[model samples]
Target chain A: MTDALKPGATIGILGGGQLGRMLSVAASRLGFKTHIFDPGANPPAGQVADQVTTAGYEDSAALLAFANAVDVVTYEFENIPTAALDIIESHGPIRPSREALRISQDRLTEKTFLQSLDLHIAPFADITDAASLEAALAEIGTPAILKTRRFGYDGKGQARIMSPDQADEALNAMAGAPSVLEGFVNFSHEVSVIAARGITGEVACYDPGENVHRDGILHTTTVPARLSASQRMDAVLLAAKVLNALDYVGVLGVELFVTPQGLVVNEIAPRVHNSGHWTQNGCAVDQFEQHIRAVAGWPLGDGQRHSDVVMENLIGDDMDRLPELAKERDCALHLYGKAEAKPGRKMAHVNRITRPQK
Target chain B: MTDALKPGATIGILGGGQLGRMLSVAASRLGFKTHIFDPGANPPAGQVADQVTTAGYEDSAALLAFANAVDVVTYEFENIPTAALDIIESHGPIRPSREALRISQDRLTEKTFLQSLDLHIAPFADITDAASLEAALAEIGTPAILKTRRFGYDGKGQARIMSPDQADEALNAMAGAPSVLEGFVNFSHEVSVIAARGITGEVACYDPGENVHRDGILHTTTVPARLSASQRMDAVLLAAKVLNALDYVGVLGVELFVTPQGLVVNEIAPRVHNSGHWTQNGCAVDQFEQHIRAVAGWPLGDGQRHSDVVMENLIGDDMDRLPELAKERDCALHLYGKAEAKPGRKMAHVNRITRPQK
Candidate 1:
């Protein structure tokens, strides 16, 4: 509004994984310094960040110091502790708002919020105990997933029920935490809209990308998604509706199911999403930069993609293919400098420019 | 020949200015960490680098320590002191080779090296004193430039002569340093090839970019430069010739003059050049990443240009236009977080995607 944060302004980030690492690089590209706060030592983001605080979220003094040093605060992941937000928010502004985090952090709350906007979502019910779980399963039927309401990602903290008989095991997987029962939607495939809203209430949405998951992990995302003009419009419009409804001031990822009847909402992530990584090569401004621009109050890029790209994640042993991938034509690699190649860990991603769609 | 530097490998970089800053970001994208060695405190590159050794190049102990900490060493500036390079090279390999640096650090050596490669270069003579300057003037004639043999950049350490009578003033401009006298080429415009050579002898050259200067500093570099198809091939071939001749293992900038007869060599930079910044948006693999790949013993990118881009530098007061530029469509900004906007200091650059060429 009043001239975006000046070039030297420092941005405080709450998580220091691959997302935080990328956000740090993006901040630098725009002349903004980033100070990363994470409990882990030698966080991936710390390698590229201007400053880093290796302290837990419960360390209020560290949180306060970090907030004081940065002009504004944003985050890489949505599961930030409420108390940490309270401490940091007291010193400086946090983009995307605490309200956005509150909703996305809990599955029940997110689905309810989306439904309130008249957006179609998978039928879901809350579960508090054994009886509640049984009742929800009875109503939602089999072929459902039971997920913990919070602290879940990359298919963690969830269990699938093939039939009503498996409801007990699924509920047990929750470990007695409050949960949500989501009846599987009959959808052809999954797609996601990476969207952003600026401080001036203007919204921009990148074209939806078709997603393919392997073993509950994102395998690849291809732009020029298989979508009719109406489907693309629906995806972008619904993403904008969610952004405006939350008064969001940063990028968000909205995953959807391309069902036979219409598009159905799967979930929303309040920060840059892995599904949007193709934008690093496909668009003039990537999701990380767009998030930084919105949080800094700069004008959003028009979100017009210049190239068609296929982004494939390099998980764990995929690092073995570095030699082959490096030799491949038109492949731009974005590797997270994680030391260990533990199974299922995301080591890097490669975005191959297929061609310019235009 | 072998695998590229592993993701967690550290790359030691000399000269922590904007070039090192960009190189650091590119290394991070490939999952490598960078340690910057700069004399200045809080260098722009330090903000993004994993480590910073704020020690002057003359500090042999610091230079040795920096080199010992990384897998290999590379530099951002060509004017590194011979003693400092000796210290670092004794500890680890220095890419682009010490020979490449030796040739490029001095204007006289660079010209001689290019001529040895059978490349077309401007007529030049080494100048050590008034007699030599006068003799060179007689041979080269008026409208020539006298440039210091070493440590000159951005048109500094040079003086122009329009007539023979101005010889004394031009010689005095050198202030007793070794100098070179060059006859100005009657050319139409300037263009540069951003070229790279891998450790295994593979070479890649980006399409030549037309360069326009303002106050003797690069103003903008536009890809798809005005060149006949044959001229374009000449540019790339000559660039590859230079790279292979030097056994270069990193990116080089080869400036050329478009003349009525043919393309003439203007100058060569052993490291990344400001004129090549357009490749960041125009090519699948940018010059920075290409340089890293070369030095790390990786295969070279195909150097394919997907979009037409114009890269404009933001010098000093040009930072004032950030607000306006931020709002422009297809504009991708890369800003250096220098605290003060000193006159002539390069503060940032913007790459505007003109359109896809194919």
Candidate 2:
């Protein structure tokens, strides 16, 4: 096992979004300085990070400098190019590992990996061409989603196949990119487990949080998700199994579909997830800090939920409600410091604590 | 009253110490950016702030540039020179106001201000010279403390007068600086209330926290301090009175002595105090965020303590315990990203929750 980092170590973060911003804040709380490396100028994370390098992923010189300046490297998002990882890993260690990223980046690979572990997942088939798409639809049937194998987020790069007649249109929507046809699960509700694994192989999982989505975007996540005691234990155990199988060393968000049969594994994010944002107000140690601790090789903190919280994302024009939200009692606001409030863009979020029955 | 600031506004912070570092983090959470101005290079606040100006307060050009870059100006320390404020105020509004600083910066003025509010305060006399010192000693009697009128912190520039024979020695310790001779209060313990005043004149106060001192430095602050219901109300009321009197526009830390008669005001800090560190873990909105909200003209948040917390400061060599502390459950650590852990320096702190009887 790698030795834990001492205080005052510099942590290199490869992303400059809200996740990176919150992670930098958490790293600072642990006496670790963060250097944010992103191509975007004045990114949200750069506003709070100790240092910022506005350079592209292919900039080998910049990447080398960033790697040499920090004790460890971690990414806020999972879509980092393999070329970038090849350069970053040469100078320092990267937590959560490249293998986790490789599998999660491709929907086909992720499904195959989960199925290999005997984990219950939705019926899926790879579609690399028109012939393959038709064959997959014949097997998966109607009511399936055709999603691109990589670089898909927030409902983008996806099309629903409602009937066999629409297969041609759905295939056309793939735009020649490799895709995966996933049979829909009749889930009563969706839930996510934010789990962490330390370098020493210890694992911890937060209680599952029920999630509600609108327009394929997350709207709200409520902690203490409605789950049977046994189901809760099952969700945690499944998440631990994934983390251990990958030899992960950071926080991972495992999305699941809760059906009458049991919990079906949907996908896994190799970094802190939006559904886990409620932990910032509901637990003693939040997911951002938990991720930082794990990546720094420190012991994972307690993930027990101390308060019931409902976290709502402020997307698109939600910036107009800031005046009222700022005045709400028991509400904690977390703004991403984005310059513009573009449509579907996540500008901020608020976590309202409803528990302890205060 | 000034209009409330919207998100995305820039706040200029003076003195880039740990308090400023925390305040910067809070500002970022509210979708606001912070610019830290300090003479020291690579200050703790600079690690989290969006901008850093390494210039002395007396550097007029740099001070004006900083003020112009931000929507408003606030400070983490009370010892800013009057001349610097003159230049800064010309560019942007300064929160807590210059009046609040003038009163809190000097021990003599702080005592007089509390007395003016009809609040209980220890008897004090101004000491400008040897004759004044001797006369003040006669009036206050032995067992008094001779402290510098300004720029004193952490028990520095303070001399104990245990007997009449030590008067000359104590007076010599002042070294020609203006001083205050305060008669000792026979109090059971010390407590502090972290209070906030919004731009609209709204006031809020956190529950008092009892403090313990070791070597004239704060060791720990425990929330839900031992107090009767009435005494707690009194503490809150006294803190509000101080804030309202000054028309303060940020968080203030009011130290009090719980004497047999009633609560005696010891002094006031214009910004968040070390004693209020427990709020970061015990309250939904911490003192740092509370200060940010007030200065931003947002509504005051609920200051009610939700959990019982013991905030212990990691001073100097106490850094050695961080490894063990990191493994302790229910502990939230806040470290100041300082490079050195010099003697008597506050390197970090931990708030251990003893709440919900877990």
Candidate 3:
């Protein structure tokens, strides 16, 4: 099969959440089977995957067995334990590579990498303790966010420092873990570019999507983001630079703050992003399939959008509106088969095709 | 759960071929799990389904277990054994009902049913024996088709008679099985209406797609088929009439011959058809998802096409061209993870978006 996996090759996915579920579906579309490895029983992706390994990442034996069972391993999320990744890597390749994971897994490492690339990023300082926190606060300013340097997502393990007086409380939120204090970027809006790099060093980027967040979770993403022609070009160029620098394969999500000065790199995820969900309906080749193609060594697909779409995440009680959403015209519902829709949990999403833009 | 199966409910599907595979994926998008029951081991749909029951229809025990496990049962093919259906129905409800299956399972019955609805159909007569075949030949005339009343598809189980002298050969091709002799329609082209009827009896139809066949197998289907506005209306209305007549639930494919006089009903499928594959790329809610929604008792999604698409089947050695197709711009490839691609076996399909039509 060479580097490009033939149809029927099994892809091992690390997380069995909505992203993995959709990835499994996309892999199936390309004639590839998927095996999901997640700790949770009957995870969302497990419902569609050909096989499931219901073992935690800490289980070395299970991890080894999982890696041995599939052609290659990929993940829907970062933050994988280093030992687990070592075992999998020893057995088979991991798409997006371990360097991309190591960099994005830590805030300090991520911001440093982006800064080294000469990309615009928010002012940031590393904080180790109360002394360092005070010093960093003095340098970065008071109106900033104090975030744990690792394992923070969806506003978790972070606290906002609205004023100098709130420094102590904000620092306490880090709970003695290594943290980074980031000065807030005064931007008009947030936008994201979902990009992919193939094994052969080719890069493709979807158009930037204007994102709106509520409670630090993605609420909606509308394509044809309010970007100037140059900013759109800059976004794709920056994404390509990052992909080349990392020698990355598979999809990456770049979140940027659109400021008057330029686009600021807010963060980067080494896998499929929530904001890219619009591509499921707006493009012939979506992000999930593109990621699979890249990882499997297939040629990169065209990522141009054909429809203008507004993708709204269905959170918690949003399931209550499903009756109406299902009947809405030109609205496509993608529901994660979660047994319970906990508050703030993404239960589903709906992509409303506004019109054919291309 | 009422008539409408909730998210996480299981949908039991018969015939785990490509249609079932796509249906399972669509069911997952709607937050439903699928259980595929097929006699073949490791069927394509099983690769993506939540569960699989690999037992033949004759196995009453497996049938009972399968029916009991699912909230509702639907099928990819209509030729389900009656005894198997009886067992499933005894345990739970089957969408599209037994009536639709009964009517479409045999050519004679299907033609008779279509004629009863006052729809235009090619002259057809039942042939139970050589005497009956001779009588039907006298009525229907030469340049006819002698087809088995049961188990015929993709030009199989039928023989073409270009002259009266070929009648005996054509009749012999039936091998003493009940048959139907039908006079060929002088049509410009063939088109199909992929329509769905919800549990509440609301009907929705996708724009008719023009079909081209090779070796009696569907070669391609292009949306926005060459039909006048009135012809389009007639096609949709005829499909709606069939759905209403059968009190059908789930998607149905109605093939029509576009004759100079009017649209002639060639045949109808009780489930999703190959000619409707274009909807996957052309419509917001495709035929597979529409079928899942109907069987699950959800509202019928809007079936309007948003993009101009041409879907071509990858048959047998056509799989060799996958590398080129994968690199083709605006093309979406859907491969069935079949182990072997024998001659005439549908290996996959590629939908090429020509342009945004709507």
Write down the TM-score of every candidate.
Answer: 0.99, 0.98, 0.99
| lDDT tens per residue, model 3, A1-358 | 2579999899999999999999999999999999999999989999999999999999999999999999999999999999999999999999989999999999999999999999999999998888887888788886899999999998899999988788889888788889999998999999999999999999999999999999989999999899999999999999999999999999999999999999999999999999999999999899999999999999988798889999999999989998889889999999999999899999999999988967
Clashing pairs in 3: none
lDDT of each: 0.93, 0.92, 0.94
* Per-residue lDDT of candidate 2, residues B1-358 (tens digit): 1488877899999989999999999999999999999999999999999999999988999998998999999999999999999999998799989999999898988888889999999889988887887888788888999999988999999999998778889889988789999999999999999999998888989989999999999999998898889899999999989999998999999999998898999889999999999988877799999999999888888796767889999999999988889888889999999999999999999998877421
- TM-score-superior candidate, 1 or 2: 1
Cα shift from native, residue B99, model 3 (Å) = 0.3
lDDT of 3 by residue, B147-235 (tens): 99999999999999898788888888888889999998899999999999999999999989999999999999998899999999999
Measured over the true interface residues after superposition, the C-alpha RMSD of each candidate is: 1.1, 3.1, 1.6
Question: TM-score of the candidate numbered 1?
Answer: 0.99
Docking class of 3: medium
Ten contiguous residues with the weakest lDDT in model 2 chain B: B349-358
lDDT of 2: 0.92
Per-candidate alpha-carbon RMSD to the true structure: 1.1, 1.6, 1.0
TM-score of chain A of each: 0.99, 0.98, 0.99
lDDT of 1 at B341: 95
